[model samples]
Each structure stands twice: as structure tokens, then as C-alpha cells.
Target: MAKAFKYGLKGIRGHLEPAERELLRSLFDDVISMLEPEERANEDPLAALVGLDTDAREPSDRALRRLLPNVMKNDDDASLEFRRYTERSLRENKIGALKAAALSLDREHLVLTPDDARHWATALNDVRLVLAERLDIRDDADADNVHLMQDWAQAEDVESYLALVYNFTTWLQESLVQAMVHSLDARR
Candidate 1:
């Protein structure tokens, strides 16, 4: 019989003494799966023609109904050790109007703190261009979107911030522990 397993698990073949690295990878995979395609729903004409229909377009869903959520609102990584996602959040935004808008945030004028969500605070226009100069936005549509983000994020004060952080941290811890437990259980 084997002595231990790796995924923080034990005894199972291919699972001996699993380390944090494996845990991280597992967690990363889970997180990535949760990353979501930015455009969740935009009205499919064919689906509309069916009479009664719905479009979930999101990563998390139950068997019967797909859910539509604002991306990263309830990210499962709240349980992890670090705030940084394995993938750079804006990797895809680099060449778009969103990228231009991102370059325009000044931080000083906007009174906008990093909010952990960092540049992802959605939009700065709602804050009255407080951080405008420091931003690099060029698209007028994105500017409109910023106006929208500012309104949405204004309410995300301390309590909500802590809640998000807590959720991510707890999620990571649980996944790690679960993976470990799974490995150990398999050992038997």
C-alpha cells in the first residue's frame, strides 16, 4: 500500500501527498472555469422566435436554469491566499475601447481606491471624472459605460468589500481542504 497522496490527499494512486501546488492548480482551474465569457447574453433572434425562452450565458448554473450574472460579482476565489487572479484580468481588454478608457483613470481626481477589483471598478465617469486624466479611454461608448459603472460601484463600500474578500478567501480554503480530504479519503 502507498503511504500517502499529493493533492493534499493521501494513499490514492496518482494522488499521493498532494501539495499546495496541486491545490492551486485545481483552484485555478475552477476559477478559470468561472471567469466567464464577457458577453453573456445579447438576444439571440432564433431563441426569441421559439416563443418562451431564456438565455443564461453564464458559467454557474443549475440543471434546469442557466443564470446570468454580472461577471466576477461572486467570484469563488474569495477563499484563496492571494487577490491576484492567475490570468491578468484585462488581458482581453488591451486592444479595445475598454483599454482606451482604462488608460484615462487618474486615481487622484476620482478618489477611487483600488477596491481590490482594481481598474475593474467598471467605469469612472459616474464619479464625475475624478480620476479621468489618469485614464486612457478613447471610445465614447466606453465613456458611457464608465458613467454606468460609477453608479453601480458607488455603493460597494467597506461591508461589501469585506464580504467579497471573505468569499474569495473562504472559497480557496475550502477547495484546498476539500482536495486534501478527497485525497486522504481515497487512501482508505
Candidate 2:
């Protein structure tokens, strides 16, 4: 029973059919079965995140230098390729999250955190200009309803460098959040 719930948990966290609520119930049961009495204490995530000296961990610059694994951060082209891959990953993650949120809430109207969208609308439009001339994708631009490439344009930052120690959390989140709102509006 415990194993069944644990296995079901993976599906609950994933994009799947609504009928999977039965599995979600199993997952809840598994979580209960897995629960162990606290040895010391546990902090709620929001409190821990906002409180001072919360045992928050910081990664060194050296760690960041090696952040992009499997893509090889050692070489220059590899670095560029890795950045591209990272942007693609973020875009996919945000959009997928959007869909997931809509499904979870069972609402046609969905909203996303600003951090998810990363405002690059103007930048994306500019990229469209370049793609139009360079790749000759202009005339066919409106023809494709899905704006995959534009998302890549806003994905310009090679290193969104972790926000806890970095600054982009604010500037980037505002843009991203706005973008999500815009996207929701478009869908609506």
C-alpha cells in the first residue's frame, strides 16, 4: 500500500489525466505512510525563505562555472550551446507549468508567476525582425500560430544566475510575470 502510494505520487506531480485522482489518493496515503516523526524540527518553506540565517545555502562562483553539465561548460561553443539549451528548458518549463496550472485548477483562466515568463516581449519582437531577414521566416511568421522562436529571443541571458545570490530575481520576474499575464490574456 505504501509502495503503491509512492509510485502514484510521481504521476500526481506530472501532467496526466484527471481520472488519476485515484492515484493521487494513493499518493496521499503513501506520503502519510512515509512520514516519520521529526528528529529535531522542520521549517515551513515560506518562513525559511524569508527569515534571516535560515541555513540558506549559497553556491560558489566555481560551482556556477560548472553548472551546465552534460552540455560541457569547459568549451566556448559548448557554453553557447548550453545557454541555448537552458533557455529552451526554461521556456518549455514555463509553458508546461502554465498548462499544468490550468488543468490543476480546472479553470480556463490560468496565471503564472512573473519569474516564469521573464519579460522579453520587445526583445522577442526584435528577434522576429532578425529571423525575418536572416532566416527568411518573416512572411511565414504569422502563418505559424505557435511562437516558439520568440520565446527563445527573451531567453537571452546566458546565465540567469541563481537569484538568491544574484539580482535578476526582481527585474526578470516582473517581466516574466507580465508575459504570463499577457499569454493568459491571449488565450482568454
Candidate 3:
């Protein structure tokens, strides 16, 4: 079991059992792997240094597409053009957040500064997005269906296991958001 994150005198605090920590770290790593852009040979070093990706195209994977959505839904050419310029940086930023969150799991106790909280929140949300795509959770009804799989004992299949994971991440992210809100309110 994990304690819900809370804002207090020191900072945002929470506790996860070792197993929970491992689970979160694995999730973060998986998302980071998915977001890492492929290296292109013969690419201009100057263009790469400035976050330009002339070869970038919309991701074929459903989850990757969700993570790196088009700037304009209805305009394919414009969207692809924009992605060529921005997708690499977006992937790098997401990877950075996921890596930071995964590294934080090495601590026995979770004590988060505002920046850490922001990273955790982003990483968790990305994990949930991937899980949701895997679980085919497209709407409120789909999420409700997945949320019903709360029993670990009943996780007899991969989909059930993913549902349980999704539900757990959703709960964790909600708690984080609540703690973040409390922290904001405390400053006022």
C-alpha cells in the first residue's frame, strides 16, 4: 500500500512500499523508452543541436501519437511540418521528466520540491496515457470499465493487469494533483 501525497510544513510528502516504487519506476522507464527519438545518420550536427528534426514524422504507434499529437488536427501537411521542427524537443522534455521521476524512486521516503512534483505529475500522466491507450480507454465509460478492475487477485490476463496498473497510476496522479493544489493554497 502507498500513502497519498500530502502538502505539509516541510514539503509535499508521500510513501510508497518498495514494490510500489519499483512499479512506478518501471512505468516511468517504459514511457521514457517510448518517447526517445531515433538517431539519424548523416544528420547535420548544427540542426540537431538546435532541436531541429527535418526527418521527423508523426508517430505510427497509437500511444506515441497520443504523446506527440499534431499541432493541427485537420491539417496533415502543416502538422507534419510543425512536428519536424518541434517533436524532438518535445520528446526530450518528456523523457527528462520521466527520467527524473524514475530517479526519485531510489529514495526510501518521497519528499518532493515543487519542481519534482511537476516532473512526477507529468511522468505519471504520460504513463497513464500509454496505459489507457493499451487498455483501449477512449472515454469516461472505458475508464469506468478499467477502474472496475481493482482486485489484483483477479488480474488473470495482460489486459486486466494493465487496467490495475492504469487505475493505480490514476489514483497516484490524483493524489499528487491534490497535494500540489494544497501547496498552492498554502502560499496564499
Could you tell me every candidate's TM-score relative to the true structure?
0.21, 0.19, 0.98
Q: Candidate 2 clashing pairs? A: 114-177, 117-176, 118-176, 119-175, 119-176
Top TM-score model:
3
Top-lDDT candidate index = 3
Candidate that beats the other on TM-score, 2 or 3, i.e. the better one: 3
Candidate 2 TM-score, true structure as reference: 0.19
Instruction: Give the range where candidate 2 is weakest over 10 consecutive residues by summed lDDT.
Output: 1-10
The alpha-carbon deviation from the true structure for residue 125 of candidate 1, after best TM-score superposition, in angstroms, is: 38
Candidate number that wins on lDDT, 2 or 3:
3
Candidate 2 per-residue lDDT over residues 1-188, each given as its tens digit: 11111112112111223433343333223322222112226655554333322322222223222222334446756545444435334333333443333333342222323332232222222222322333323344542422333332344453211111112212222444454555556558
Model 1 lowest lDDT segment of ten: 122-131
**Model 3 segments more than 4 A misplaced:** none
lDDT of 3 by residue, 58-151 (tens): 8999999999999997999999999989999999999999999999999878999999999999999999999999999899999999989999
Clashes of each: 40, 5, 0
